[model samples]
Target: MFTFEIFREEVITCYKEKKQQHKLYSQLENPSPGNLRNLCLIIFSNGLSKEDTQTFNEFFNPLNQSNELETSINRFDLDKLRPLRNFILGKAKNPKDEVVKLLAILVDFQPRPYENWKKSNSTTVIENDNVESGEKDSSEIEAEIPVNTEQAITALNDANSLKSNSKSKYLVVTLGLVLLLGVFLFIKYGTLQKQCMYWNNDRYIAVDCKEKIPGSEVIALDEHKLNNFRRITRPDTLSNKDVSRVWYSKVNNSVEFFTEPGHHPLYDKPLKAVTAYILNQHALEIKN
Candidate 1:
């Protein structure tokens, strides 16, 4: 597995080190699926140096084309990445360490079964050639020297026992590590979920629930409100007529309207533009 969460953490750490404002920062802060895809595109499109760009283009031909780059980034195409990894390893200096890390993850996502197969095939071929040339096989030589069949059987059984024990130990260790990782992730996610903000004067700002302010009202964190923070993107098709003075929550059986553009404040949903249909259908309700 690529371990996207680890990769994301690395990217954020690197971004913090740079301490510069960029599209990558925004994507990191709110890593929705679309934002993550855009983050990859932004890194490739703008983050690479001149030499790195040339090298990338050389390995992934015609990646200068927007569509080609988009497809490669979207898929994390390993077929196109393995060569790039080899090239980077052979390079004298690699300025883009993040890109190198990404390539490493993508290229090493799966074990190369073919390498093992090739080694096995070569050994078999060499053994066949020796037999054809009338060379005594190791088995044949050992057969003449083996005087104690019982001892040989006992040794073979012991070897198999050791191998079985080793496999059992490995499996146990692997399962233990997986369980630890799961517990860590669960704790981390729970902490993030608990991180909520209270609506201050005009805008919401995160604060310690334990601290008390003298004059101003100090409200506790509301997970629902924090989770519902909306990032509205205006559609290109939207017109003046479709736009309204107030925002509207998404229609269910009944439409609820808001005075401003944000979340529903109570529901786990975002507020969107009040369409003409909502205006007409809820006209009687709005007057009251």
Candidate 2:
């Protein structure tokens, strides 16, 4: 867990100072071309256009009414981070406007290890250094399972000969049944997928959530198996590809919402609900 309170203070403090500096630069209604040139350099170096300087500066100025800088900064707010991101960015707020959010949930959100850590009856295989020491990690075991195939050319040839003469009526019947079961399952899975994505676009961060984020914070989730988390379990957002997002429950045990590209954290719900959900679901706890 991060010192969220400390990070919040750092963000507020930095913003206050930067806001003061921005006030000074902003006080000038018309800056000289040389100053503008420097500003232009800043923009170009940061991949912004010279023509958009006014808009960019204003956006970063907090006091600016409207600009691109504003839109970009809006995306980097803490409320937009995943539980894992909350553990990585720490308390420092970068001055840059283009802070691309990456999906690194393992950097934050540490969970308690499972109680029974040594109950494995199966041994993980080792590629090298195979010795009397039988201890191995999960990676070794996963690798070993993929290489234990038995060669079946002769058996396959015999089976082919047997099938060439025998009517194989039983095989045809079994295959037909399997085909029917597959279709039925496909229909059921389609229904579940829709339910998983039911709440994707409904909960606006402004209403359904209460994320009072101050600045960049990183929440580590080293042991949390994010990949194992199923997409909404019911029917999900109908995405064509796999997606990841930091999500918190909407109505306690009810469904959760995800952020696009990466995860965003939500707050301000009752503590009991958040606590129960984390302990029971969310994978906030580490599993390593």
Candidate 3:
């Protein structure tokens, strides 16, 4: 019995078969540029039902006047592109489907598929200058339509803001790392290079010198190699006798050496005088 349910089922089966064929077409190994046109022709001739063929003809009749089929395909409305895109997606998702065999024949044909259109509920409203028998002007209709964009606009703004903040953080981190690296290199290499010095004995040494007054203890000629002192006069050049005791006089600002006070007239005067030290070692010894 030819019931309404059976008729509806047959229509559904026809659509399913069309989808399967489209999937095969997408997976073709190599197809000529005219493969889609030829396939459409074949569908018109044999694949489609009489009603479907009639609908297809009505849709494409105006495009027949144009020589460029690609241009006509580009002008396809969302209603027409949705089914084709879904078919291609179905093929991509299922590699082992029997319908994938058609890809071998349609491989050479390249078609640009519609992207992100599946999620949109946007409608294309036609605007005609001439009003139909009872229809109002498209301008008035368009004015009455409300556009919903809050969610999309907010999502887009948030994404852009996040990207900008990420870039700023990356730049700051890179600069900070570079600055730290420079400081580390300076501390390790620059300070060592500056510390190097040549001693009076023609030997290299790292002298730990500091700023001080010339007459202070820190500036004295000493045995330590790291000291900043330099020997100006030798001990032997100052006196011929053995002078064990050395005193520095503030009035003369010179080193005065004292030998045993013998019965010499020069005992009141210094036996040896040098241009460098100033110290009262006798008081320190008595105190100790």
Best by lDDT: 1
Against the reference, the lDDT scores of all candidates come to 0.48, 0.32, 0.35
Q: Identify the candidate with maximal TM-score.
A: 1
lDDT of 2 by residue, 132-248 (tens): 232233234333443324434544544455444334655786899999999999985644422211112233211112222345222322111122222243323323121221234
Worst 10 residues of 2 by lDDT: 100-109
lDDT of 2 at 190: 49
TM-score of each: 0.26, 0.15, 0.21
Residue 62 accuracy (lDDT) in model 1: 45
Give the number of colliding residue pairs in candidate 3.
Answer: 8
The lowest-lDDT stretch of 10 consecutive residues in candidate 1 is 105-114
Please list the residue runs of candidate 3 whose C-alpha ends up more than 4 Å from where it truly belongs after superposition.
Answer: 1-148, 191-195, 198-288
Worst 10 residues of 3 by lDDT: 109-118
Deviating ranges (above 4 Å) for candidate 1: 1-196, 200-207, 212-224, 231-273, 277-288
Better by lDDT, candidate 3 or 1 = 1
- Which pairs, if any, clash in model 1? none
